[model samples]
Target: MSGPLSSLRVLDFSTLLPGPYATMLLADMGAEVLRIEAPDRVDLTKVMPPFDGTFSTAFSYLTRGKETLSLNLKEDGAADRIKELVKDYDVVVEQFRPGVMDRLGIGYETLKAINPALIYCSITGYGQTGPYRDRAGHDINYLSIAGVSSHCGRADSGPPPMGIEIADVAGGSHHAVMGILAAVIQRQQTGEGQFVDISMTDAAFALNAMSGAACLAGGIEQKPETGLLNGGSFYDYYQTRDDRWLSVGSLEPQFSARLCDTLGLSEMKGLALSQKPADQNALKEAIAGKVREKDLAEWQSIFAEQDACVEPVLTISEAAEHPQLKARGMVIEVDRGDGELQRQLGCPIRFV
Candidate 1:
């Protein structure tokens, strides 16, 4: 069956991960997403390492089902052409810094004047009209500025940068998609186009909602590896006998008790390890000892017999080929040409 967004037309004017990922999601839901690229701009994915010699896997994954068009916005009539194109499009996504689009004469105001029902979304590190609106920044910088990175990493360790681009993908792309959907719904009701100013900093702050809540309550200051969710004894990763890893998320007392029982540590029954730091450390040591006795598969089998919320940590390839993942169609094979099929991560949405 076709998807709900089959009738929608999206004009993607942004490059890189965030904007591309958002449009990719729209395309997956059956939107006709036209990706506008400059002729002179080399695909960053090509410059990035780990290409499969056919196309950059990043590009192949993110740009699926989208038509590519080359256009130079700086040209005299380019903005006019874009304005003409916007009249028929349901959404226009741009990731330029604030005022860049306005300077190009194709900003939300200009386009909304041309088409009153355009869902124009502008994504940036700092939102429009902010003190840092025009300041240049990337995903890491945005996360740091938004205080999202403050709660990550080891407690005693230096405040290292997060490996993933949380600000870009989670903050920028995901939020943009959500904003676009909301705007679409609002437009349906009011028949009015609205400008969506999505700031990565704001999105990052939203992403750290739990930490923010804790901070606001004057509880733990969200110290890394010391929090309940981080690498605490009750809920963390432990290395098995074969150097494989298992993640235990038995945070609650009931589940923690069950985990202790599963490991034959009945002495831990009456201990409130979660509340006491000394007891928590002892519990950690005990769990690590038990986990070290077996390989990851053995622990997986043991956990399957109980409801300890324990799971074996799988590598990317293993995760792709996992039975549950395969059954759920979380990994899909796409024809990459020349008789080769590339394994691409599937869309998470399961449309009923």
Candidate 2:
């Protein structure tokens, strides 16, 4: 906790992924984040799997480098006490349906009345004012509304729920962080704080930059498995002989040429993203055929010297131990309240 945001203090009322992770990034960059937990209800994340004797690995891992305070905000004096404490904090992050915070007497207006320079960030599925703002949603629903789900998964199978909470992490968490930091800078210049309205749906739509650009520029809708990076051509997953998967991301022409040469599919070198679906499918199948002829280990050895973005699809443990992440210090050992050093995700942003 000794980075750029060391002097800042964040008061977080976010329970699950979005707000917690946003504050987690801030805490990693040296903000003092105080998580205010509801006394009556259990944090759902605390009950999730991969536990160490009933302690949730996910919850413990995410809550590292932060302090928690349990309080019943419904209590008579609790809101007042919170307001008093908010006077000192630089930022406040909350993830509740619209008006919930206002009803609790802890809305942005209420907080700002007490501290004018407070940066209030509200993370929600739709936002604070939209029609869907009050509606309940998770990552999937947001992705669906943002048109991101339509471009995901295979075209034949239709869109499937992404394996990870892409919307929550990418849309909510990362966007909230960006908005909060931007607000921090704005506050420094204007000597005032403002509300950061972060909608997961909006963030997901923004993440559609690649597909969105093509759709706007070409006046064409993007179907699943049609975009270059979205499994359109040879730049996709191929099954190895051992049933393991290898991701082929040779999108650049040079890399595509190298990949084609490696697999003896030299004709597909320049047609990495052919407008003709039949041609693309043929090239993909040809590459897939070559890949399936070898086991994952054999292919790994064969591509050892290659600069292509081809690699085995690894499990979480394998990814944590991968040399790329290891070299970047993305996998770290941390003490998550057990007085023992346990493994958790590390700081991705390096100051240097």
lDDT of 1 by residue, 98-177 (tens): 88888999988889999999999988889898689889998888988988777676778846776678899889989999
Worst 10 residues of 1 by lDDT: 269-278
Candidate lDDT values, in order: 0.85, 0.88
Compose the digit string of candidate 2's lDDT tens values, residues 1-352.
Answer: 7889999999999998888888999999999999999989888899988786447888887787899999988899989989999999999999989898999999999999999999999999999886887999899899999998898898789898788898899899999999999999999999899999999999999898978988889787898787777887667899999999999988777888888899888876656756677888888888889999999999988888998878888888898888989999888878767677778888788998
In angstroms, the error of model 2 at 118 is 0.5
Error of 1 at 253 (Å): 3.4
TM-score of each: 0.94, 0.96
The backbone clash count of each candidate, in order, is 0, 0
The best candidate in terms of lDDT: 2
The segments of candidate 2 whose C-alpha lies over 4 angstroms from its true place after superposition are: 267-274
lDDT of 1: 0.85
